[model samples]
Target: MFFLGCFATATAAAAAAEVAAPVPGYVLDNTEVREIHAASLKRDYQLYVALPDSYRASERRYPVVFVVDAGYAFPVARGIASRLHRHAGMEEAIVVGLSYAKGDEGVYSRRRDYTPSVPRNGGYRSDMPGRPAAFGEADAYGRFIATEVFPHVAAHYRADMRRKIFVGHSYGSLLGLQVLLTRPNTFEHYILGSPSLWFDRGVMFDREKAYAAAHGDMPASVFFGIGSRETLAPGKQRSRAEEDADMVADLRDFHGALAAHRYRGLATTLKVFADEDHASVFPLVLTHGLRAYLKQK
Candidate 1:
């Protein structure tokens, strides 16, 4: 009877241990999610990090590609980085995706964080009846990235600060431009896709003008891409006559300005993808952009 009691107790304990075992769920093989409190923005952010396959086995530091709009762009960036490094002979890189906290659709947050200027009379009046608040907080956002994000990544991972790259699209590209113009050293290379230079009635041109006046040279490599079909059309809600908002023309003009300036240490390339629209060109942009930048030493 004593032996039987001991057996029963051991069997019950084993069952409880089995029940407490954790069930594994599928996850990206080399990715981790970090919840960070951004003191500059006074809010929380989710940073998705994808390390190279050899990161754990090797002590070598790797270049980092920081992707903005990570909620939608992270997977694409991570997959492309892996494929390019594995098959295309490009250098392996650590990809970091900057994401927002839960429940944030990113409409207001992105606008406020990515744009460089707000209209004088407050926010722009949207087609909707109620106007959203004014934005133009790129400076603060840049500070957060430079101070908080960079330090955190460096502390926890093997990041090569000298080879940092910034990738962004649309308004995110505008933010990239702001960082490029204001804090050139923050990123050594920039990949800007379909930059919304139309924001604030061609305000970015003024920014370029100011940068040119203040500095004689820009030491960076930039790849600017746009879709061929991004030209003016009735479906696009803007007419060709309105050149300020004409995306294709604006991109070309911006490229022309950069080329004409011929900043001593700047290397710039512009590519127009055929048959692609604003939303459809990102993957192509990223692939080409990564190849172009990664081909450098």
Candidate 2:
């Protein structure tokens, strides 16, 4: 009788354990939310800020990485940051994720806040168009980061000003490139993944070339990455292969422009992940980029 009771108890415990296990690849948890209106877009952003495990253990200020398109990228960033700290001897950096708010506001809000300009065709083009007038607010977004956002983060967190980085993918990368072109040193480092270079007829690449021609010296560290499968997405009114080829060509031109600057102070790296697609490549990018970025420190 006692053996039967013990067996029943073990069975129930095993069932409980199975029920309590977390789903695979489920890493994010709802922590906090904040609203910031900048770049002329009313944004209710979901913020996922992760500190190093040793942050509180030892009072130390670390670098910060601002992540755009946080909905999909934050978990990847967090995981990469933690792993890098453990295995690669990378310094712990604070991650600030910025995501669009819910409801009718989010669709148009990110597009306007992250893009450089609205194309003449009345479409953002790189991204499926949403609200037309609200597009091309990247400059204002930079202002928000430099003024409102950075100050708030600096005051609240232990962050080093000179070692900060801005990370973005797709339209977000378009904004990162815009900041690098005009602002130059807003963030000491930039991690751009799969930037939408087809937007507005590749004006961003043109701006890079013009900047290289005009400037005598440029100083910044940029890490550019693209997934091999990013070109697989079906396009509207355009051939997928043509779009991919254009994007790849523009990216190559942009990288060449940066390289052509040959400014002794400028350092940049471009990488392509052949196995991962646009949605699946960010984690690897963050891991490799962070390891490289920390090598300087």
In candidate 2, what are the lDDT values of residues 1-297, reduced to their tens digit?
999999999999999999999878644542334556553445444556777777777778889888887877776787788778787677777888877645535547677878898665563333334534568888887777887788777887788888888898888898898898888789888898888887776778678778777886667888988877665446644322335444544566788877877865678998888887767887777766777687532
Alpha-carbon TM-score of each model against the true structure? 0.84, 0.79
lDDT of each: 0.87, 0.75
Model 1 / residue 127 / CA error / Å: 13
Q: For candidate 1, which ten residues in a row score worst on lDDT?
A: 120-129
Give residue 24's error in model 1 in angstroms.
8.5
Q: For model 1, what is the alpha-carbon lDDT of residue 278? A: 92
- In Å, residue 15's CA in model 1 sits off its true spot by 23
